[model samples]
Target chain A: MEILNALINITDKGAGFLHSIPALLIAIPLGAAFLAPILFKLWKRLAEIITGLAVTACLVLAIYLVLFLGNTPIVYTFSGGNWEFIQNLLPLGIVFVVDKLAAFMLLVVSILVFFAYLFGLKYLERFTGLGKYYTLYLLMFTGMIGLVMTGDLFNMFVFMEIAAISSYALVAFGTEPEELEAGFKYMVMGEIASIMILLSIAFIYSSTSTLNLAHLSYAFTQMQTQMASTPGFRAGFYFVLILLMFSFSLKAALVPFHSWLPDAHPSAPAPISALLSGVFIKVLGVYAMVRILYNVYGFSWESSPEVFTALIVLGLASIIAGSLLALNQKDYKRLLAYSSISQVGYIILGFGIGNLFALIGALAHILAHALGKGLLFLTSGSVVYRTGERDLGKLGGGLGKYMPWTSLTYNLGALSVAGIPPFLGFFSKMFIILGAIDLARVWDSDPSKPGWTMIAVAIIAGLFAVVTLGYLLKITNQVFWGKSEEKRTLKESPFIMVFAMVSLVVLLLAGGVAFFFWLKPELLGPAADVLLKGTKYGELVLPGLFGAGG
Target chain B: MLILGISLVLILIGLYAIITKRNMIKVAVGFALMEYAVNFLFAIIGFHKVPGMKIIPPILMEVKTTANVLSSYSDPVPQALVLTSIVIGLGVTAFMLSLALRIYNRIGSFDLDEIKRLKG
Candidate 1:
């Protein structure tokens, strides 16, 4: 009975000091990042300790926020303790809104960052310039957290650049010829994308006369309803929206704009690769795009069917193209990177379907991929660390016999990613397929069109899931089932690496089995609700104006 | 409208260099050009040149009262935005230049075609 009361209290909306934790979430990391180099000069141990402590603290706060924002959003204004007055001038001050979606993302990113830091502690020992690596890594961490939490559009752009620039530097940290080339390519593409986004933001600011997300949403809605909307105004708004889509698609690595990802992901350090492949694209590219479209611009299938159709087409293309490309990769990390692109297609398709189940599926896929793909990358890194090999042809066959723990974890990861039953990926893929069918039914509201295209696309996506399994199983078979190549004995990875992989594997299994029972109600359901609410999100974040008027 | 068109043309020129240039330093210069174009556009967006009002700087010391300063001075917001964007552009340019230098050191050339060791 006492435990039940505590559980209820945990779910209740927090007040006072807890409300301020969102700011500290970004601040702690940013502060520690600046201090890391100075402390490194003092003692190498101190810098590592600070980074670990900062990430762990942020993770605890993230988990706390997830529970605290179960039903309520904390709208924090960065004013001089006079938010009451500034609340009326909503667009003037910088605001950080911690809703269920933001909290969910916070949980996803912090968990990955914390584990990656833990894994990198020993993994990075051989590399020089450890100080710079930790600094840039923390900066990247702070930028992503800020991106998800900021309520200002321009602030999002700023944080996005922070994340992008830091990542470009980290990708080149290896300083290899290939790494530098990949980093330069990524930097150029990323800069162009950011510039396009900035142009859109400028256009938006001109039209709406505000840079705050909530205010812009309110103003855009009002402008849509007003008869003063000219053809030129509509043209400009549509142009800005299209630019935003293109830019974000570039960042998200959705097929036509995904040329940079295959090179950049494989070129970075393995832990950074995991961070990039697992969460970076999702947060910087997918999450920001969704927020802008669904919440800021108020996208609905009934209202903007063309936009939804565009999303579906791009997603289908990515699903097919990314999978086919992954089949031809010789390098282990590049194959995984291409697979990341393919998995992201499922997310985009689910979101484009725009049903409750599909949105839930998309969010679930994000968590599943974060764990499964991150584990795969870490295991691959461990293999390389043990025996400096990245080629598939040279390092295969009976190696699994020597390192049974790594083999088991890799197989589990492969199984989960391939959507095997009772694993996390299976449930996410099931919901997405179901959601696609539901979308087809709704889209066929006009009797003339049968909506077979969407159904076919769903079928094709499932077939591609088979392709995913084919490739993953091929790796497993090639690596584990053949004759042993190395003459010396191989041992399991150290405890730190094993602990990281084991935690991810455990979560992946538990999420799959307990998805409907606990995960949905506690996490995924609320997150999808936030997306489904659409422009009603504006009211939730800023209650002074447009209160409860959907 | 003319200013916007000029800014668009400048952007196109920069993009042409970015897409067609093979030298890494040329690409970096192209990026700088694009950055400046955007900054110019931002300046035009915030420019307030009312014909009848007396022009003044945004600083309060230049004006006697609040009303005159409000009507005559520039909006200042876009200027601030341009300043911040310029700084960000500088950082990106510096980082890109450093990366280009490292690539040159690695391959002993600045041409991008020679740096194709990472192809599929």
Candidate 2:
């Protein structure tokens, strides 16, 4: 009850004019990305130190922002707040609104980014031209935090482009023919998705005449009520939403739009891979889509049942197809990449159920999958760095004897991702199942009759958790354990790499219990409330929507 | 509606080129075509038939802002949005073209088929 009180009973607290932190969050990374090359030219070591400091600073600000956020969001309007003559509030100019949901996402992005930077410090030492790599990497980092912070639609598009373009460069950073091939393919698909997203933005801006998210929500709410009866307006309105969904799904790598992921993810260096899988897809794709659909458009299961239903269908396809395909992979990294698709399917499914419990489940899955998959990828990097081999069949057999830290952490990650007990992933999956069951109960109009379809969805979702175990354990059975004909000289990774992996595992272990304790009130509850409250977000941002549209 | 129809046609053309053309250069060209189409659509969104919109730019310091300027602005917000979007497109294009050049140096051909070394 106390924990619930923490989430529910949030006061503005003392952080009133401390609103400039949001701008600093974006500027720190952007400044670092631009300065990295010059700093490298002056002293090779200095560039990385600056990058480290920048990422750490961002993390500090994000943590402070979330705690300071309590319940009411921190609204920072660029240029508008600094000048009085302009007279800008929510309706005008670019706004950065960091509500509980955005703050939650901000914390997630900064955590993974900080660790990935740590892992990369040693991992990328072998590669030459370290300057540009750090530059592009930081840009990707800024792009992520920027998009998450922005409450303007066009600003979101711009940040999406920044992240997408840099990732394309980073994916091919190794410069091998195969890496180039993967990068090229990823660029094409990503650009296509970008154009589609741009088109969707244009369509919305044309209709609403406002790009600010709060105003769009106000305009959309008014439209949903007033013009909803007009068949022409309704169809066009829905078409815009569907277009946005398609473009973001392409970025998210959900089933049909998934080809780029397996190629792009594994092709990048390990830390970059971790960033892409653990955070990129979620922030740019899932996070952005959820923001538009729920907050901006004020969609819910009740308001827009078919949209939820469509998402459920997509979620199921990705879960089944991704898990089934991963079972056949020989490359360990590729196999992990495929399962990312499967896990994302689970997250989307939880959201598609579109109930409060389901939302909590979905948000938990995002956090779990980020930590679990991130740790898995970092471990994969350790293996590759030491052996320079990625093939599971060729690289394998009884390797755990040598690399104890890597092996131990890998097992914990696998166990967590595979949804075993006492780990964060298990709780996330458990919450989703409970949510599905809750949804099923509500799905049936008659108290006497059970909702058969939703019950099946619950069972199917639960079974896939086991399927997650199946593919992940293949790594244990094949790569970590088993006898080999050859005995090769193997060593545990450097202390730094091991340290990075251990930190993530520590997060999965202690963080799981902490999340459970803080579960209802502090973190996920208010964040989920942002979705459940729906159009209330617009009202919160801009009170009295009366003449606000004009 | 005519402008929207034209943009759709351009989009279809771009998609066709991307899907059917085997040359890497042609694929980049296809992407540029789509970018142009999308940019054009956004800019046209700003080109209202309101008087003085074409003759006088709306961002001038002299012009007094009106709340209803949105529906009536001759050249409005989408124009600025398109400019930013176009610059982003330029960044993406430069990256893609440089990558293509490097790929060409290694393979000695710009064939998409040759780039398919990674297993599906």
Candidate 3:
């Protein structure tokens, strides 16, 4: 009876309750992460339950933030809020600025993580060291949630490392020669990304003398305007930005720097693969990059169209290279891995377009691809669980008969990824393609002339969606429906696995249509508005500087 | 400035080793070198230039220390950050070396060229 009251109290969402949430969002996972190993020693079963409960709590809190945290951002500073002497001295202490963008990310991560952990519980029955696996998984979870919430640039790098390091270990958890090698490759690339990011932070610190994102934004803008035509400063600025782009592109698996992904992603145990491909890259790579570029540095589409164009070139390369390369891959997971790169290209393309529709499409693609790729990877795990087969050509047709749920979910997920009707991916792709067309026709930074070159680029990008369909359909034909004769000894996956897969599919379908059509634009508008606000982000986080001084 | 130049040269050498070296252990070494070079830059950048004066520790050494002296204190923020970075570097290097050991246990070689089975 007492416990029930406590549970009810936990659900209470009041003004006081809401203020404490941003810190709890990070603290719960971080606490659980450290507690997991101890729980492992106490009781093997206890760890999984704790993880589930913690993840569910995170999801609930995230949803709370989404519902209540409207336009007014939540600024939770780590140190005392009284400001006292320290506050007047400087922008002291790490602050978590939970605006619409941050809240949206928290929601996306928690949903995907909750389902993936649900899937992992049943899926990881074959593996040993469940305790250690849960520990690292929780750590990575903490890192992901913390990465999104923190308002400090240096802290973001710290969380990024925590996530990156743990993931490298998780990728090699299988300990096979292939898995270890893949992990090594992944580590090398990931570490390089980290180093570059650290170097950038150092650069920012040297120039601005503040590591807080809001403060840095304020100072950086001040510096740029003051020395608008200084050649040396501009050169240095471009250098740092280019370094960041290269580093983050590597993290995002954008074409030229994407070699490690096909190997690293497929080589991980399937659930980790799902987490990595689905949410990890988007958070660590795309989200972080966008935050730094658009918000902190305050680069705008109108002022710096060149940077956006460079993003387009990268997106174009990834789309073309990723799709063309996946055509002949016989391995099932590897094909999906390559598909991830291609799918990610569309997200980058949306960012490249850099308008409201394009940005909305890109953010929506982040959601759609997260669920779609997650479902597909979970389906792959189910197939592996039942039959231990990963090769498309070798996996005979008749698979649907044995594993109806897995096959059905896979198809739903595949269709979504390929941008078919009703599923979330289609809507996201539609927005992106529409954004592309709009870019050529309407979104002209220079009003004197039409964007003719952009139309050709738009057309090519729009056509890549069909190419995506081609490769995905081939997977269906080859793996699940191909005519074959083999003594079939396969059964449907566990209830938990199927439930997780089906839930993702439902969410994918519901979320895609519901977001644009059913849900009020007020919710989605603020999210995209965060990006559109551009350099004004600093003003939102630290109003004293940008708000009053101007 | 001299320290920055030295660290930059060290970073270049580390990059060279990372790019050119085939041995997995040497590659790890290159990573360490690069990490140290970066760490060096972070630590040195915090030093406040006090003309003809000794470097003051960031701690409050005396009561009623002037605000000007407090403001002039070397940037302890980056130093604190570098400490965190070093610890992260340690965790990363330890995990990486363990991976190398495990890989060595399996294939009995540290040559990256030999462990190229995962290429597309």
Candidate 4:
């Protein structure tokens, strides 16, 4: 009764502002997406303008939300909006908890979506159904934003499905055989991953009797205490953890489970590909992994050594395997897709190292990779648009001669992803490798232990770095620098596309230099703190839901 | 228990069909079978055994205010989730069927091996 009173009091104090922000974030684009087709019927230009404005407004709103709740978490609850039946049945219908981490993710997603939509204005002209494309794109945007903000497990799954299904359709938008095949393969793998997630949720719900993440975390803590000595329960927990890790890793396309990405990413149109590689994988896979590990399962290296080892092993495998795969790819988009796998490996490795510096590196890498890879894919799209060629071997000639702006941005993007200094990627890689070394030093006192494994992984990461540099340079030389034997007909892409590419390049460089001043404390610090104090997350989220005193 | 066992068997059969079937349509049907098996499992998970489960009362009568009312209300959450999942499955299946039809139209075959535009 007292707890309920406290909750009511809290709501009364801040419910008006807090409750509306998340809904506004989700509803604006979703409503725009829905109205886009109708608006297109009346005036086609209005559809793009409305969507671009909606996304930009969302970006600004997210930035404001982040600044407003700097280093502080905001919890908002909506009890079915005065619907009597729902209110009576499910008193606590749904809640959205938007902390700094969610706000940061929302910012990243909205910015990317805004740019992608702007680019789509010109790029989507060739496609038959422009209105339908924007509609699906807006739906995808809503799902990602909602996924980041929602604090319920089932709601997250629903949002994830929304995003995944829309992406599958977008990938197959071309209706060509390759696109269809890629979409089919992507759907199959995605369905399997979703099933795994559903099964895991079913197990968790049956065990905890709740779907609210905060409540579930509370239940998990109580279960842990009561069954601390029970080996069977511990084993079951580990099994569920592995299930989640596997499912999320599949979504992230970490090496062994990465067969679908190279196909699916290359098959999608440029803007869609940008979304897929830039933010889709991060939201679906990396964000969920971080949330579950930090807030739900309460895992860290010091507490759960086995889980940490699993993460490290998987990250290393992806790094090495993705690099090797990229070395052999001749298709331009497929090569970029492989590089995405490798970059994701770097992010996962940073998280797996389980330190503050590593977490910062991981977050920074997500931001940088999104910009760099997004630019690369968009540039490739422009290249394909102008030349109608995807094979690297068939098309080679001074692209820089024809499209100077695109070549410049593409070079900057490649250099960034390859971790060249003065680009965004280098700072992130440096921090992550330094964190690994620090962790190794911490574990070195015990000579019989495998502390040297970190050093070995670090070396492998370095070697992969060189491999990435080699391929990126090879691509640059082949496509942009060398002259073709045959006469190649190429022209610069439309102004809008070039503008989008250039802006992203500028943002990437600026973000790289101003990492400390801009992103660190606002985004990275709080996220790292959440991960570092993993189990305390339960206490923070479910303050009155557990223990004897309650 | 019997329902659970049957659903497990159905899933195994679906898996077998998926692995052994050469026709794309058959493979798609196998996927449907698997989805049905999963849905059945979910429904079974929500089901509770009880006596006097049905009540045919007047339209506007006193509601049953018994302990059984609370105890016998099956897990409606999973049921709702399953309904949504079934609809999603239907959408995906329809899309796949159309895709298969398109492939057949283009390639003039139902054999999966012959419709191989994408390869390593």
Top DockQ: which candidate number? 3
> How does candidate 3 score on lDDT?
0.85
CAPRI-style grade of the A/B interface in model 4: acceptable
- Estimate, for each residue in A1-550, the C-alpha lDDT of model 1 and write its tens digit: 4743453353333556567777788778998998898899999888899999899999999988887664768877665554466474464666888898899999999999988898898788888888888899999999999999999998898899899999999999899999999999999999999988887877787677678888888887888855255888788888999999999999999998999999999888889999999999999999999999999988898788889888888788888899999998778888899999999999999888889989999899999988889989988888887877888888866878777878899999988987888999998888899898887787699676568887997898889999998887767777766787567677877889888888889889999989989888889999999899888888877777775344
The local lDDT score (0 to 100) that residue A483 gets in candidate 1 is 80
TM-score of each: 0.95, 0.94, 0.95, 0.91
Q: What lDDT tens digits, residue by residue, belong to model 2 across residues A1-550?
A: 4632342233223454346677777878998998999999999998899999999989998889777785667776655344434333345666788899988898999999999999999999999999999999999999999999898899999999999999999999999988998999999999998999999999998888888888788888778665757898888887888889999999999989999999999999999999999999999889998888888888877677888888888888899999999999999899999999999999999889888888998998899999999999999999999989889988866888889899999999999998887888988888888888998888787666458878998898999899999999999889888777787889899998999899998888876788757855788889999988887777777653433444
Q: What TM-score would chain B receive for each of the candidates shown?
A: 0.85, 0.82, 0.88, 0.81
Ranking by TM-score: 3, 1, 2, 4
- Give per-model CA RMSD: 4.3, 4.9, 2.8, 4.7
Residue range A1-550, candidate 4, lDDT tens digits: 4743554554553545544677677768888898999999999888887888788879988888877774446655666355434432232666777877788788889878877876777788888888888888998999899899888888888889889888988998888877877887787677667766776776676667678776766677678675689887777787778888999999999879998999899999999999999999989998998888878777777667888787888888888888888888888888899989988998899889878888888888888888889999998888888888888887676888988988899999998888888877888887788888888887898786678988887788777888988877777887888887877667899999999999999988888788778777667787677667765654555454444324
Model 2: residues with Cα > 4 Å off, grouped in runs? A1-17, A80-90, A446-450, A544-550, B50-56, B59-73
Top candidate by TM-score: 3
Error of 4 at A140 (Å): 1.2
The window of 10 residues in a row where model 2 chain A has the poorest summed lDDT is: A4-13
lDDT tens digits, residue span A211-261, model 3: 888888888878876568788888888888899999999999998999899
lDDT tens string, model 4, B5-110?
A: 7876887787677668778788778778877887777655765555765642212333466655645456677777788778877876787687677767766776
Model 3, residue A207: displacement in angstroms?
Answer: 0.5
